[model samples]
Target: MTNSPVASPAQTAHSTGSICEFQPVIDELRRALNSTLKGKSEAVELVIACLLARGHLLLEDLPGLGKTTLAKALAMSVGGRFARVQCTPDLLPTDVTGFSIFNQKTREFEFIEGPVFSEVLLADEINRATPRTQSSLFEAMAERQVTIDKMTHRLTPSFFVIATQNPVDSHGAYPLPEAQLDRFAMKLTFGYPDRASELEMLAENIGAADRDRSPLPAILTPNSLQHLQDHVAGVHIQESVLRYLVDLGTATRHHRDVTLGLSPRGLLTWQRVAQARAHLRGRDFVTPDDIQDVAAPVLQVRLSGDFESPQTIIETVLNDVEVPVCS
Candidate 1:
């Protein structure tokens, strides 16, 4: 967590896992997530990468897309306690980070835990929450700890937040402050499904309207998942590829449209995310392509600029940088 991701993930990483040992679980996770959100294999790949990378994700899209479903599926696949919070204008800070209440019988104040205690948390319509309430998650997401009433509470080391928000241009939506956005590693969208995937979904739902489908069995225990994360953190990156990542980061900082460019911390997050992408592609070494593939979404959420479309800035930066050749 010291902004040097090459040495470790967000936390200390150690594993007794080999690639062969992880294949089955990774495939199971892929199937479960892919089925839950159909016709989004590309997005599914990114979601898995984010999980293995041990990073939070921000999902921005229109309503009724599979944002909620995808969040649920990811939690279920990871085999963890999942909590959902429906953000609203009136949500209080204590409502998210929990509050202290007196136990009448013992006469001692009890600290009630909130959604941040869960391994996977879904913040639905996050922009609807007031700034103070949203700020409740900042410490938890970044440092894996929450301070309440001058006492610090530690969350699960594997804690991951998947926050979804409607487009900023939508009515009643509040733009997230840059500090909040920087906490997330990637921002993605689950766009509308293709025709075939939609038809299959409708067919499957026809007879199951009132039935609650059993979730997929846990493909990985916490230990196993930790091992996969360790593996991703250990994925090798060539010196030239590291330089390439730095070059891309510099481009963002120097861009004319960028008001607040990618910070050093964001650059470290980018390094970890790119490592996850390489692991997902079954590679032990990072490549220039891995960095470029994740550039758009990883940069989109954190970069503050005057540009209307974040994608345009990503394209321009990617175009401006020269790809480094690995020796």
Candidate 2:
């Protein structure tokens, strides 16, 4: 709310169409994703919104719920390299961020790039990794760079992480520290699909792609996707909406049940994802609806409460604040 003068929603006309020009690519990405995962359109939309916002996703779900499939589809659709790490208790920090190895021929310790170097990194069962290993990603996720042996390495500009955790297994898993939780933009769950969707999944076979004559194509390059993210960043939000956002954030902080509320960083992420939601709706300007629509997912990653579920506490926080009426 303090960074720049908030523009009128009506002034957003100039911000339109940049994202629309890439509609064909977005549509194809959606289609390819649906073919891979049936009856999860809502989850797919949230994933796209998170992608355009350039934020990390934390997926908490049971095994075999298609979390990895979704991540792979997204990575392929963008035509970026996909890397997966099945995190375990013994997974080392060097394993995630890479380490220096002495090369006799080069006569130097050359850094070996790890899974973090890829554009799309799937840290499957991330909670299973030790905290020391998990902390290695904090810098890369936050700064987009890693420092090893006094040298810094920059990650791909379009780097996106989809980290998953299994809630059922607690014996060897370490609960993600709050600091790690705050780094992700959203924590989503891929619940089992409905009965009809289950039947559809039963009938899906990638080998049958030839029958449909449609295969997944690289819908957009990493650079092009970065441009689209810039367009999403430009979507305008009125001053009134900023105040509404601030109010909601404060309400969460003051909520008796919540021990840790949304931070300044989290609030900024909230604004960004709102911009993305508006862009996803084909609008150049953000409305109050955009803020509320993404509130739950955004809040789920940041807010911590003692008694109630995040959804219940989030509903309370939302009800406590008044949504702005935009012209």
Candidate 3:
């Protein structure tokens, strides 16, 4: 792991007390992902934060960039059930949320679960699915459950989705709706690897056997993950820091280039993400640095405007808003 060392899991935990006792586990998770993802250390960290915050992730990049590998690595690290749905134009909503089957022998209906029932679901090339099929995920992503036949089924407690889409300009791809885009906690892109990392990858490829296998090791169970999420919820955010957060959201709304600013749900999502980042650093309370650290990625996913790029618009918003100094 080439990334700089974060706060020692031990030092910061005592200061933060019981609310953040699981910092060491998060540190371990970060190191594991860093090793698994190779040169994309920063992206791995953000993905871990998104998971800790209990939010879904969206990966936008070209094919063969290890998008699927990253998702699998995260799922394996937690020993979570990983299911994948390959989205195509003909995919139906029932295909994703599953359907009821009639048992001839028993003369009763049995509801067979779909890929969405797993803890970590990888929705690959989600844009290829029809809009109706895509809409099937909205309820599950927002409420962590699915509704079928006027009956609801609860997803796994650690339900986390990693949905990937090719660039909209690509043929056979559909642009994600604004509502669908908003459900993603953060959108990340993993570009080509650096020369050194690519060299390492080549070496690994040569050394591997005919069958490729996962290198990720499970470090936590579902219950342990739920506990860590509980701790993330307890990370403190003072009134001043929250006001600063609100200020950024408000500024985005008033930005001339923006057609739609951060929604109320988006703002709340940002706060939880910031809290997760802080908790990962072994801090119990939120800080402006934490907010700034995550501002670009979080805002980039949901913000829309007339700007040249979402990244540029987010950078401007960050500059326009004043940072709060917390004692």
- For every candidate in turn, the CA RMSD to the true structure comes to 5.7, 6.4, 4.2
**Cα deviation in Å at residue 115, candidate 2?**
0.6
Per-residue CA lDDT of model 1 for 241-290, tens digit only, reads: 99889999999999999998899989998999999898877778889999
Winner on TM-score between 2 and 3 is 3
| Candidate 2 lDDT (Cα, 0 to 1) | 0.84
- lDDT tens per residue, model 3, 1-327: 224353544333324345435656676788887776789988988998999899999998888888777777778878788888999999999999999999999999999998898889999999998899899987789999999999999997779999988874567877787878999999998888899998988888896773676566777777778877877888899999999999999989998999999999999999999999997777889999999899888988888878778888788878888888788
Tell me the deviation in Å of residue 128 in model 3.
Answer: 0.8
Worst 10 residues of 1 by lDDT: 1-10
- Model 3 CA deviation exceeding 4 Å by range: 1-20, 210-215
Per-candidate local distance difference test: 0.83, 0.84, 0.84
lDDT for residue 291 in candidate 2, whole number 0-100: 93
**TM-score for each of the candidates:** 0.92, 0.91, 0.92
